[model samples]
Target: MRIVDRAGASTAGCILHGAVLLASLDGGRVYLLNGPAGSAIAVYRLARELSAFDFPRGLGR
Candidate 1:
């Protein structure tokens, strides 16, 4: 699913670009954290192809 739409891209879901393997979490929850130009999308991004690139990135370092 798209977290934001600024590229006027009518796409839904991600592009799986530059993904990462996050440490296992509680598993009972679905965490949604995105920043670093959609770096957070790495995990599921590389898999599901999630993306926030078109949207404005937020959250400070």
Candidate 2:
């Protein structure tokens, strides 16, 4: 999939959850979305990206 950025540049998009969610690379961040939040979750660095994906798993189930 291809997505347009704030600068109007077309970039590759990685679809998540069967197209209901999208992850894209922009500048220096990996943007995550739920498709209904009206905004995105962005990870700007390797550590931040790891932490972002890790935080959700920290809650004990």
Each prediction's TM-score against the native? 0.20, 0.23
Which tens-of-lDDT digit does each residue in 1-61 have in candidate 2? 3344456665444432112212232333334534444223322332233432343453223
How high is the lDDT of residue 58 in model 2? 31
Q: lDDT, candidate 2, residue 44?
A: 30
RMSD of each: 12.7, 8.3
Question: Distance from true position, residue 39, model 2, in Å?
Answer: 18
lDDT by residue (tens digit), candidate 1, 1-61:
3332233332233323222111111121112444446444444534343233422332111
Clash statistics: count for each candidate:
7, 0
**Candidate 2 ranges beyond 4 A from true positions:** 17-61
Pairs in steric clash, model 1? 14-49, 14-50, 14-51, 15-49, 16-45, 16-49, 20-42
Best by lDDT: 2
Alpha-carbon lDDT, every model: 0.31, 0.34
